[model samples]
Target: MSSKQGGKAKPLNQPKADKKEYDEIDKANIQKKKDEEKMLKELKAKAQQKGAFGGSGLKKSGKK
Candidate 1:
């Protein structure tokens, strides 16, 4: 009988070298995303505090 006819075979385990490379890439991508999010959050806080183009530095504007 053919091997396929017997049953589905288990997939081969990943080699240590390939696994390490993938782990490093995954970690780098995660760190980069975290850094970008932190920067965006900081920019948003600054923008809210300063108003558009840092105009007037007041939280709200009022006509005198």
Candidate 2:
């Protein structure tokens, strides 16, 4: 029942290491995510326009 065995008393004075440099990869991943999100949004809009989920049923009202 010792406190040492219970994992206590670690001060928050440890120096944290810097993140690894993967800027190019990170940028590409972020761009990919943005593109994916944009595509999904567009698809959702298209599906809604087609009344895929019985949205407003106004998709065929033809106001455009």
Candidate 3:
């Protein structure tokens, strides 16, 4: 079966996929989510290391 790329919007009126295709789609979505999370983590780590925007911690306000 042909594989569809991630992040593409599916039409609401489209027919449902069969078991195998559905499984594949689910797997693809899971992978995409995981990859996105990993990338965000890496980016955050890099930012922390570089002190980008003053690392990952919240800043203290001098409120009276």
Candidate 4:
């Protein structure tokens, strides 16, 4: 294989990408993930508050 194909790139042949653009995109993705996690956590806490449907399900094994 040619050295260029399996080794250091030929700078003249490659197009350079803007670093600032990548940084902005990465920041936006991080913020979006944080928001989703917060929402899921809130939902779980709400569900645990009262799992039973107003005391109207299977009876307890040994309770009055």
Best by lDDT: 3
Error of 3 at 30 (Å): 0.3
Model 4 poorest 10 in a row by lDDT:
1-10
lDDT of 1 by residue, 1-64 (tens): 5545556878899867653455888999989999999999999998889766746545755876
Candidate 2: the clashing residue pairs are none
Worst 10 residues of 1 by lDDT: 52-61
Clashes (backbone N, CA, C under 3 Å), per candidate, total 0, 0, 0, 0
**Where does model 1 exceed 4 Å of error?**
1-22, 54-64
Clashing pairs in 4: none
lDDT tens per residue, model 4, 36-62: 999999999987897876768886678
Once model 2 is optimally superposed onto the true structure by TM-score, how far is the C-alpha of residue 48 displaced, in angstroms?
Answer: 0.5
Give the candidate order by descending lDDT.
3, 4, 2, 1
Winner by lDDT between candidate 3 and candidate 2: 3
* Per-model TM values vs. the true structure: 0.47, 0.47, 0.46, 0.47
TM accuracy, model 2: 0.47
Supply candidate 2's per-residue lDDT for 22.
70
lDDT, model 2, position 47? 83
Residue-level lDDT for 18 in candidate 4? 66
